[model samples]
Target: MNAPIRSDATPRLEDYPYRLSDNVRFADLDPNGHVNNAVYASYFETGRVTLMKDPSKGLVPDGLAWIMVRLDTHFRAELHWPGTIELGLGVVKFGRTSVTFDQVVFSQGRCVASAQAVTVLIDETTRKPVPLTDEVKANLKPWIRRGLDLYQRD
Candidate 1:
């Protein structure tokens, strides 16, 4: 999938509709004293999972489950331990059987990493991709990325 066209301008945390805070753990550090690159994926996952798994969100329908099909990450800055990080996620695209999300990790007001993840809805029994239901689409509308024209994108 083509990544979104990012402007030279920096991204603001508030641009994302869904936001959460997490701590940078000592175990997340690498030999260079920066957060391990692999750990950023977990932080991004926490943002997406927290939003989709919330009962109030109504994202996952009965008898259905979401599975990650793709994740593209961009590491922006070095992050140190003993600090709190902010995570943000916003729905960027809705396909017939998949949802694409734009995610970010911020520390001390600076963006540390960003990613795009694609997840497809699947039948719990068959484990096959399923088209998104109207209810699920409606529930996701409010979570779209701010300043984006959802209809204009491919």
Candidate 2:
């Protein structure tokens, strides 16, 4: 993974605090010549990890971790090789014990895929859900996109 390529020409994504860059590998392509569907999931995972590892912006504690509970994805365009892909990650909703993420994959400034995931924090020792601290919630507030609240309609 690499740092995002930034430019004034790039449109500001909703409210992503984290952006990760990844080059499309030959092995990522399927027989159809486009990146495989499963590869998209891995890309999203990479985005999450990059976001979580940032000491200033990440919330994954030393002894605790977030686990993906669900993921909903939509493939809008086929991704080709010999290109760099940018992934944008933002917090859509913050819950007592879970956090929802909204992510998008872009290639050459074109939106390739979109995904939403719900992840819950758990104590590594107890393997049980842990409540989000106030500090963590406050830190994540700036990344929340007001109208993109998915997986929590009610």
Candidate 3:
């Protein structure tokens, strides 16, 4: 008989940026009785924030916000009703003032949804794109996929 794949050998989505919790609520479902596609954005956003900056010991308060420049969501399967979810996030590209985030939602252990977004960091006052801090680079370096910065940054 063939042996089952070990958990350690499994391609862990959490290894890159890490996984976050997502518990579906009644409101999460639409009239169609499944989680709304739009709500996937929120799930991804929360996961990205937590991965880039820890909640308790977070990033410097330089008065900055990450504004989405683009977003793409792909639904692999339908998830209806209340259930626990896991959101895995990873940094694809890090730029002067922007970062590409790839997010995936797993129902139980299978990927049910996926999303990608580019968020440009900006000064809260000027709302203009700014350079990335070394601190942020050090924090997110491990999570970023290799060659993600081959493209230009806006």
Candidate 4:
């Protein structure tokens, strides 16, 4: 099971250890003149994929792959095109076979959306869930969200 999202607290970009910048494309705008709501998922994906897929991160093993199993999203504000946006991600919990992340999208220093995403590590050939290795857990320690009691809970 995944941890519940703590939406009562305000999100700060610095609290997330992993962050990246992306531009809002013209095509992302909806008929209402704001960025389409669905586009926020891709921004969150960029943050996770960039960190996990990098060889130096050592988060993924050679024969294993990470697949998203759940994403609980909260849309907080409207976003317009012709601007840049910031994405933030932090590891919130580590399950026996899955990892959960707290991700946020910020535009002009204000949070536009936030989500709690769960991804499972699976064997490529068998397509079965695999238990997380100690090494992978250690590698993710640096990316935990600050000011959380994750160590004691998980």
Candidate with top TM-score is 4
lDDT (Cα, tens digit) per residue for candidate 1, span 45-78? 9999999999999999999999999999888889
Q: Which stretches of candidate 1 lie over 4 Å from their true place?
A: 1-4, 7-9, 151-154
Give the C-alpha miss distance for residue 145 in model 1, angstroms.
Answer: 0.3
Model 2, span 1-154: residue lDDT tens: 1122222223345456678789999999999999999999999999987777679875777788888999888888899997899888877667779888878889988878888888998999999999987777777766665444443443
Candidate 2 residue spans exceeding 4 A from truth: 1-15, 146-154
The C-alpha RMSD of each candidate to the native structure, in angstroms, is: 2.1, 7.3, 8.0, 1.6
Task: Name the best candidate (by lDDT).
Answer: 4
Which 10 consecutive residues of model 2 have the lowest summed lDDT? 1-10
**Candidate 3 clash total?**
0
Residue 16 displacement in candidate 2 (angstroms): 2.7
* Per-residue lDDT of 113 in model 3: 80
Q: List the residue pairs that clash in candidate 1.
A: none
lDDT of 1: 0.90
lDDT comparison, 2 vs 4, better candidate: 4
Q: Provide the TM-score for each candidate, comma-separated.
A: 0.93, 0.82, 0.77, 0.95
Query: In model 4, what is the error at residue 64, expressed in angstroms?
Result: 0.3
lDDT of 4 by residue, 22-107 (tens): 99999999999999988988989999999999999999998999999999889999999899999999998889999999999999
- lDDT (tens digit, per residue) of candidate 3 on 32-105: 99999988888888887776566443443468766788888778889877799888876766666776776788
Model 4 has an lDDT value of 0.91
Lowest summed lDDT window (length 10), candidate 4? 1-10
